[model samples]
Target: MPSISQLRKEEQALHALLFTQAQYKNYIPVKSDSLLQIAEAYYRTSSDSLHKAWTLFYLAQYYRDSDEKEKALSYFQQANIASRNIENNQFKFLLNLHWANLLSDEDAENKGIEKYQTANKYAILLKDTLKQIDLYGQWGWCCLLTGKYDCADSLFNMGLKLSTSSKMTYYNYLLNCLSLTARERKDYKRALELVNRSLSLAKDSTELYPLWNNKGEILLEMNQYDSAHFYLSKDTRDYDPYFKATHYLNWSIYEEKIKNLPKALEY
Candidate 1:
């Protein structure tokens, strides 16, 4: 059997093939299944084990997005265990950070934070500035989600400053983080500016989806429901849950207002 790296290469090639044929979109599940088969086969034969972990991680994402939470959690945990066996501190830290993020358990969240911090420290030691920026952004969002506003603010500011100073365009992820923080702080104007700038430069699907979602959320909060709905409807599967939930909430609010507005006149 081929190793995990070989299987991963095949998956990448498959992705390339799919991109060349818009028709492959119809058979996405078949492609996913094939990818998983290769992953499983790789797991059975690979000795280093990290490749198997990586395979599970990729499959877990596929399942998660497909609304299979249990399977995602299972694979994510498997990836964490595999990560522990590796000698590379940086990769291990990266795996822990991701594994922690995928977990819904509170204990897992704490563990994830611990791993994230460790990864950040190691990344600094390696002078892997890009990964450092990414880790800060990830940890910032984790803190924000967990209601640690001060920690979130500190991490976001640190990452944003480093990204800006380094002129690393890939680090535009920090802009999104900044926009999120600003919005949470009720600085809608600043949030809008940061989000719009990112949207203007967003070239790929990964970048565009978040930018649109963020813009939609801000617009919704500003009572711009129509624009929010339009953007939210663009891609249902890819946008952030926070953004999607807010979009739905705003839509409901607007609908209720429309229904109840005329009746209020009687009072």
Candidate 2:
């Protein structure tokens, strides 16, 4: 059996590993496997309920990131059950937030919305303005997925109103959501305007890539082939896989717009 000190060290190491993975937005399969092993071991051996809850939470996040939905949901439920005796509102808020995010996919959006509302209550009790803003943004996205444009618009604007100069990233995210809402409404002009605003706030190429993709997609929708090609051609090799997929999908559409079926297929 690992000593308490050893368990603590392992838990801290897990936290650092998770933070690094999140910050870089890159997942190495080998590293993730190792992380899972450590988390599983810790969970089995640790006597501390809170630490066990955290371990289960990390396991849930790992499965979530890997798109193993059933495993993720099971671990989330276990984590929530473990956390029931703890007094960590912040952890609970994060737990529910992520749970909601995962559930927001496809058929479970209403359940996700309920979880987000629960998270919102915890956010209120914690009195964390930034967290509240983030919750509103995520909740808006859930609403958007559920085809509740009005609800999404209202939630996004609520976050926007709470944003400040120091919170430019969150502000930019809100603008992106608003742009999506505008696009959904077929208000291409407003969508373009909102995305342009987001672009102006971008500090680097990493930030600019997705915005460029967004602009390209909007222009494509507007039948502006030349403009769409211009934005879509910007290099996005550094983007993560999901964004890269979106970029290529948009590029394909641009090629099709010019009746270059071969080029579209190549993209």
Candidate 3:
């Protein structure tokens, strides 16, 4: 038999491969089914409780991403029970965070908030500074999306205070989120400034897309029609199939705003 560590490593690699497939393509149906079979093998063979928990979590996530929420929730609950048998706070925190995000998407906001609050407590208990910063980003966005601006501000600023000088991506994520919050509150001037700062810090196209789109939207809100078109046109690269649809939607809206019905129809 392989050493348990070696087995876990193999399982982790398999999970990463499956996760990447799911991210880009929604899923590879055949590959996903094979991975689940492999996960079941791990669950049956592992005597270690933590290893069992880890397999369960990955299976749950795959199911969730594949739109099998009921099955996902069942496995997640099993994972949670198994996780409690291990003494690792980091593991516990991650489980809580994933569960929280799922619940949030299911429209169970109160349950999601409770799970996030528990994850933050676990982060503090473990003294995991990076996890602390990440939770701030996660929870801040949660609050922002739910129309809780004051709560979002407090969480983002707290994360900023704890962030180290070397991590620009962390700061970039926070600024983009904060800019959106400002935009939702109709502080267009503040939103423009914050998003521009975010764009300046971006290290790649992934970071650039959201910020560029936000700037264009801000210009549209400000009645700067030509500037809006200019900035929005800059976001020409196809991000992915799903996001390409979003790009077309944005362009269509922009054309409507400019009263170009023919162009809107073309978009």
Candidate 4:
């Protein structure tokens, strides 16, 4: 059996998807700082082409997750170059996926969707279930962002159904996303129910924090001011870049609801 890196051109694309799957599972930036340093030194000295490309991509991802966007972008480009001789599209797809995410968050939704859809074709060719499901979930969020609520619902439900055998964490996330659709529909009661169900499924506080924030947002939409404040206040912990942005966004909205206009602006 061939390793992903040694697989044929099309199958080698699985390398990027596999790397992405393992990202959420083993990512620990602070703890791996020294390890990364050692890895970098080894990469600098190593003569193996395969190791060089792999290390480049890993460093790119590390820098990306650490919020060092310039370095991440540089390394991603370098990694692509390092692997240019390989008969595989994994490197290109990996770069495109990250670029798509950045584009989506920066308001270039159509460009982002194009990249994501292009990558989805590779995922489908590989029969990568998790990647397929993740695309649906992410694409659904993009739709949600564009106020296509019904389309978002269809995509998210398809993702949720596909992920039935996945981890509880993913299941809860889909539930949380579904509640977002409900919240957007102004079905506050349904939103509350969906979020509460996610809370019940959460294994720990790390999982609960986002749901608390979501619940708070739903309560605010329902005009339950005090209860909204209660849940929102529970999520005081600083989160990763994406979640931190969401935290501030909800906080801003909560402040706006309470008529604290100045404070809302501050967030």
Candidate 5:
């Protein structure tokens, strides 16, 4: 039989792997089924409430990423219940933040906003500026999707004000959100400028695709069909469903503009 120390070490290692993958958008090296089994085993064996809560949280994240929404919600509820006895404010904040994300994806934007507000209280308590910035960005995106352009503008600007050169990624993300808000408000020039600034901060081609797609959308709205096509085409190979959908929608519009009705319909 494994010693308690050995079991704890294994659980900690599994937690580190899941946490890194969840936080950084990195590809998981282990197979999902294998990871799930290990996490479940840890959850079953751990005597610590905090460890159980952490395991459940990661299990929720895995299910969420896999689009098993019902399972994810169940795990999140379990995690929340398990965490009630703990005093970890940072963990509480992260839990609420991710729960908000899931809610938002489920079209419960108002509920998500409430969760974000709850998370923000913890963020304030912890004095985690980076986490606060991330919350603002995510909250602003929800507002943008709900057509609350002014609200989004306010949230993104607030985040931008707190960001600096050291946090270029957050700064760039805010710029992108602000650009979308500008576009929604019919300020095409401002939208273009903000997205261009985001593009300037992009570190690699993977980051560039979405920026190019946004630029293409702005150009499409400006009636610059050729420029829109040039930029939009750059994202054709991107496999993300959201990006692909946006590309198809914009491409349809471009085709329509060029009087290719069949092509537009095909897109």
Candidate 6:
């Protein structure tokens, strides 16, 4: 409930905190202590009704990606509380979307789908088409995860078309979603084609991580082990090492295909 000037200052501080946090995010062993310091800084300085809400959203996503589900959920709730205090429908929708996706337990898929729908509606009302497409993509993935292939396919198609149209900015997201849909359909050739398109577009942006990962996955599915290895190896060392586990898993399958049981086992 601070004045507009106070709100602007709080928003600026939150933005600065996000900028600093981005520097350490690509590392697998992300410095959690550093992240905690940033969160604490924001908590101390945030005075506006919405600033803390926005800050919590980013913190929740960071924890979610770091595999700290409990912490993620806690911040997500805090974000909701802050958003409610400000009557900020946009932030509320966004926070709900995040909380929905983070609740990935088997029992949570239905609730997640419901929240995604609600978020999508609010995003549309706000004339935030880009976020709507992104939400659709996330919702599609949720459907896919829940074994609702038809629903997932429909949602992805909508998102892809929207992204490919006027908002050509998010074309990479569209391509990635298409690749995911193709993979789900077992259309390895189409998946490879989609990933190739993504890589071409990603070369012009900072979204190289998804480009490399999708290409490697498609090559792995195509049984192109050596080629897959080359793609994965080209990724920056700062990229998560857990993805290396995927490379090894694909190599194991390749060894099996070549009738090298011992090598496969070793892999």
Top candidate, metric lDDT = 5
Candidate 2 lDDT by residue in tens digits, 11-58: 655664455446434544423646555655765676677767876787
The local lDDT score (0 to 100) that residue 119 gets in candidate 5 is: 96
In angstroms, give how far residue 115 of model 3 lies from its true place. Answer: 1.1
- Using lDDT as the yardstick, the better of models 2 and 4 is 2
Selected candidate, larger lDDT, 4 vs 6: 4
Assess each prediction's global lDDT (C-alpha) against the native: 0.67, 0.81, 0.79, 0.74, 0.83, 0.72
Best-first order by lDDT: 5, 2, 3, 4, 6, 1
Checking candidate 1 for backbone clashes, the offending pairs are: none
Q: Can you write out model 6's per-residue Cα lDDT over 62-128, one digit (the tens) per residue?
A: 7887788888888887777777758677776777787878774434777777778778877877887
Report how far off residue 31 is in candidate 6 (Å). 3.5
lDDT score, candidate 4: 0.74
Candidate 4 segments whose C-alpha is farther than 4 A from its true place: 1-93, 146-151, 165-168, 239-267
The C-alpha TM-scores of every prediction are: 0.60, 0.83, 0.83, 0.64, 0.82, 0.69
Q: Which segments of model 5 are wrong by more than 4 Å?
A: 1-25, 29-34, 41-45, 165-167
Q: What is the lDDT of candidate 1?
A: 0.67
**Which tens-of-lDDT digit does each residue in 73-163 have in candidate 4?**
6776677677677654555565556666756766778887887877677676667778878878887888888898898888888888878
Candidate 1, superposed: residue stretches over 4 Å from native:
1-46, 50-53, 56-85, 104-107, 170-173, 187-248, 255-267
- The TM-score obtained by model 5 is 0.82
| Candidate 5: residue 175 lDDT (0-100) | 92
Off by over 4 Å in 6: 1-30, 33-47, 55-59, 62-66, 105-107, 189-238
**Residue 44 C-alpha lDDT in model 2:** 61
